[model samples]
Target: MIRRFITRQLRQPLPPARPESDPYARALPKGDLSGGRPAVVRVDGATKQALETGRTRLLVAAVSFTLAFTLIGWRLVDLGLMADQHEPSLARSLSSDALETGRADIVDRNGIVLATTMPTASLYANTQHIRNPQRAAERLAEALPDLSPAHLRAKLASGRSFVWLQRNLTPRQQDRVNRLGIPGLYFQREQRRFYPHGALLPHVVGFTDVDNQGLAGIEQSFDDVLRASAKPLQLSIDLRVQHVLAQELAGAMTEFRAIGAAGVVMDARSGEVLAMVSLPTYDPEKPAAAPADARFNRASLGIYEMGSVFKLFTTAMALDEGIVDLNDGYDVRQPIRVARFTIRDYHPKNRWLSIPEILMYSSNIGTVHMAMDAGTPRQKEFLGRLGLLQPAGVELSEVGQPLVPSPWREINTMTISYGHGLAVSPLQLTSAVAAMINGGTEARATLLKQDPAGAGKGRRVVAAATSEKMRRLMRLVVVKGTGRKANTAGYVVGGKTGTADKPSGGGYARNSRIASFVGAFPMDDPRYVVFAMVDEPKPTKETFGYATGGWVAAPIAGRLIERIGPLLGVAPRGDDNELIEQMLVDIETNAEGRQLASN
Candidate 1:
């Protein structure tokens, strides 16, 4: 009809009819012959008017059609390109529904995903377009009974264009929800971060929000790195090693009836964190549902008076300052009388203890004398060199500040020597031990295992010779001293044991101690350093009314070593005394002092 109308509206006037009065006359009577020159009859005025109007109408119609077509093309381009960026939906940014699409998975050093991103479908609906909001909601609630219909109704009544039903549903649920076939409902592909290992490494592999924003742990620390790259992130953590640590620490925490537990396993040479476990840990997959207590990462964030563990640092200082020799003896029989404070051992051994024996027995008196010889200035400087008295050298943000006595008095130094007046985080202790055992090169503990060819550079905190001596002494402590319980059959583990009285209400809390053990495996050539701590452990029948580090933390470390050694490439050297001596000579030997020089 429109076409016909246009044709009629645009039709031109017909040529004036040939004169019809007479054939010859109408055709050309007044002018000469029709075929010859003089002749056509003139058109009437009405014909002329009709012809002019038709031309004007056709021109107007042509212009209008061209302009309308141009506008339609312009709008098409705008909708296709401009609207996508300028008027993006809230779902695009607020919900993980958009960003998680095709996100890379998170894997451990051994390609295990303590956390992973799985592709899943999210359910959403437009309230205004639903056929029957109440009925639809009922169907949805039935499909996912976890959702309440009242809540669904309120959400559907929110009058919003889009409301989220759920993000990242399981395939079975998605199929069920789809079976409902409710109008205005839709599914969006989303990536959900799933922790396959559950609570084992929650503190290491962090969780992500619905939109995949890292909320905690390594996930939060490296959120930007994960979002920007497609490749799987390889954390320095070994999942298998982490499991063993958790199992052993949990058993110890239960046996001793401790409030909490924490531990770490770091590669001494590269400072790579092979395994780190913080008890009371939560599952990363459901971080929101976890308790805050379970979420606290004690290994990296919690700081405690890690008792005689600091003795390692003091002895290192003494050796580095040339304040004491292996053969040099200090009289530990008399408790050092310094002002109001008195320094004594847990089980005092009254005798002239050599440098090795002082460490072997964890003698407070001998350690105080050793610290005094090195002096406050020298001791503080040496600890600072080892990254104590400050945050650890790692990428993690939850670092605990070391609690050093401000006055730096002689009494304070004495107490701090036995690991009492000072507090350091577990991470700090492990990193310091890594510096001591990894050939004296101080590398900050790393959660991402670096490619050996491209590993980071390190700062040498102590001389190679001093580091070797410290390692030997530490091994002696594990072999015959407080840390003897930590020795595993296959791994020539050497470590130190510590039991610190917890401070309470302006003074030390008697009978309350933080028991801990720090060890390194394959003593002849150190590989990994393991540190475990149980806070406020109570004496149990199994422990024989003792909660010492040797009884509590050492056994845990020993079990962890035995289980993780095979996985960590550490061979057993239970009878390799010759190899053990290569790192730690027998302190009782007459020529022990000459062994270092001979080697």
Candidate 2:
């Protein structure tokens, strides 16, 4: 009976087989099971919820990854292609060859290097990568003794992407740093402006800051030119002449016990400055450590009452204007009182003096008389023509403008005739004197190596004949009068000696004086103008207890001329006595002729 019942139930079309419940399956469509396919199973609520959550999470993760990659790609493009627009200064600093080709070298006329830029390793760091700040600082401090460990630790601990560890590291220092092998440490290429001669040309070649910006002298004046070109900037300076001038000036400064000294050697024909020196100079490598006074450029910047040097201009003016001849005489026996000012001679001859004698003796009284004859307007015009009334046209920026009397009074003219009342730099005085003796052409002093083809035939300042007479008169001074100490044996020297009291409290300080000598050698045809000045020189035993220009500066000029004559290719002659005798004869004849005319 049971078997018959079971068979009947089994055969009864099985109330449609029910599908089993599964955790991951869902219900199928109504017709999906008609072709003997497996029935779809139903899924539990927790399992379905988990699957949806996983799908949402996967979508979010994919979108996030795609956005991150896009942003990274855009940033790479910006840094690679458009970095200059976004970060110009950083882009410039990161260039591999920036410092190597930034500035040009500076050389003298003979191709001697004065100033140059050298490659150096500068230490920097990515502080974020530093594992231990204290350890890195201690290790770096050993390599760079000048750097403070405390400061280094502070910089390293700052968490900055870029931190300056040190600038301009020496090769030894760089090697020591590399040996440390610390993470985050880096080296960047940089440049340092170097002066091979150090203090030898501190004032002329000047110095630059850490970033290589020029601050003074030719460096300051030609900053743009130096940075724009790779070719060296050539100056008209002769290093050999510079060395000689510096040695002589330093010796004079020490011997005379002077507070300061200045010297200039210039080419009379081309107005090129071969040498310029100022004592109490400092090292260009360490400019900040030097005193302000040591950095002062006395040759071109410091203006002083140039004393008797002005007499050369006065004599030239009088002779050029036809206002006075070589025979013209002035009665300098007594002091002239003009408006409470007594103009007296430092070396009073107490007699009438001729024009040539006026310059030979450095006679302030005779020079005043000469200037009076020429008149104030003519004197100003004449000196202006000689370039004494304006700033010197040198390449340096330290040039001083001449201090002229604003009222233009008669006494002003008298004092100016003897190189008082008016103040000018040594450079200006040297240049003006060059004009007087250089065939009376206006000497526009320059610091550049002049091209012969482009060099201007300078404007005429005085007649050639007048300039010849002035040259003869200057020679007479070195041969017989105040400049006798400067009369070298073979080289014919011509110059004027000046000793002016320092101006103090609206009056002259009789004790303090500026002793100076401005001279030209081989006077037959002058080639160079040599000027030496000792500021506030004290009397020394060797100087016979006298600190006048003749005693203090004349010897320096003589020694300089003797040494540089051969170096400058100026052949020394046998004897200058014949030339001196001829000048004496001319002076005597002119005096006798003037006496006859008066009689």
Candidate 3:
């Protein structure tokens, strides 16, 4: 009976269970609307899995965006505040080859490009792949006229894996070579150092090797710095002033028939080198072909006994150390004799000359007496303090070491005081002179630009009072002394003339002399130091066969100061009454030792 009942229930189709009770049935579409109950939509297992994955992806994207923004913000902060000690990022980015590997540029203080690198293509050949070597050589020679056809042929036929046809090729040249349709002739990317000013700043900017390596001048002194840095090296040189100085120096060289010449213009207050010139200079583009003499930097590398320019230092030492006063006088009646040497003045005044007279006339005997009073120890210390006893501390590798007497004997001191027995470069002399007159502040020569505020913090080398006296004395020299030729209108030019016989055969040559003149303008408020020097200048008809400093170099200084004054914005002062009257001193005395003005 139970078997029969189970069979009947299964056959009735289990009376169709309700859709609300079946979870799987809720996801199916309703077939008819007759049921009155609303259909419920349920999420399937696959849809739930897809939604979970989407949420995970969105969270990851949000985290990544947050990290990216944080990194960008951190980098900005680092550049603005943390990188203050680093080089200027903007300057580094502006270099011609800053996008690739290249040396930094060298610019003048005024942002004029002195030395730079340009994009170039170097021609190289894979000899094995080159067909018809002679044809390739002939075609290449046509493109590069400077390259010899025979030389290029030999290089292509060398059977080597690679060979260089040319180091630097211009865009036109590269395009011409490409038109030849020669296989194995290819261009390798390269950079070539270029000096836009050419010979204008060869000595200071210097040249590079075939591989663009620094070999001399500021280049050698700061090679690693240039290679690693992207910013330009801004030198203290002003291109405008440099051009004027070079032009004048070249004219003097030709006029005087000088073997060589040098000139320097420096700021007395800041020790900044406004202009430096050495002739004959070579074109930096072809330094290898230039003569050896043209490569020499006479301003900083050639040491010489600077003649009466040394007297400036001697007089300053005496005044600063209290060994002598302006009123003191020395008997210059005869030439001094000491150990087979006779110290004679170029323009001797045969009488008891006052200190001002001795300096103005450049008396050797009076200078010797002043040195003896200061003693040898004091003389050595004074010169050492002025940075004259050692190599000049400039920004060049070719600085000259001063020739000093090892014994430091009394004769040495006396001779050195009168501008002999000691040899120093023109750069050293200019630096010392700047210090002596710039309110006695130590003026350090440098090639790099200096900050205006930081320039005045150097050590005090001499008393300000002593410096005032020196300014007056130098002005007297230009107005009524050997430096008369250096006096320019409205400039109040003040300076000293120096003429030293060149050393030959263990003695000074009577004929060959090094003539130099160093001057400062607007003596009421000294601004610039202008120096000119001529080596082995021959006498000219204009000077009546005189190659002395007064005839040769003094006039150059005067003309240079006049041209540069307006450019430097130094206003001309017409009235000199107050300055002249204040710096005046009694030139002679009466029997009662009272001061008296000389006519």
The estimated TM-scores of all candidates read 0.78, 0.81, 0.82
Clashes of 1: 3
Poorly placed runs, candidate 3 (over 4 Å): 1-100, 575-585, 588-599
- Each prediction's total of clashing residue pairs, residues at least 3 apart in sequence or on different chains, is 3, 0, 0
Superior candidate under TM-score, 1 versus 3: 3
- In model 2, which runs have C-alpha deviations exceeding 4 angstroms? 1-101, 453-456, 586-599
lDDT minimum window of 10 residues, candidate 1: 22-31
Question: Is 1 or 2 the stronger prediction by TM-score?
Answer: 2
Give the Å error, residue 382, model 1: 0.7
Error of 1 at 520 (Å): 0.7
**Residues 134-198, model 1: lDDT tens digits:** 88878889999989999998888777789999888999999998888787888987678888878
What are the Cα lDDT values of the candidates? 0.80, 0.86, 0.86
Q: Pick the candidate with the highest lDDT.
A: 2
Say which candidate scores most in TM-score. 3
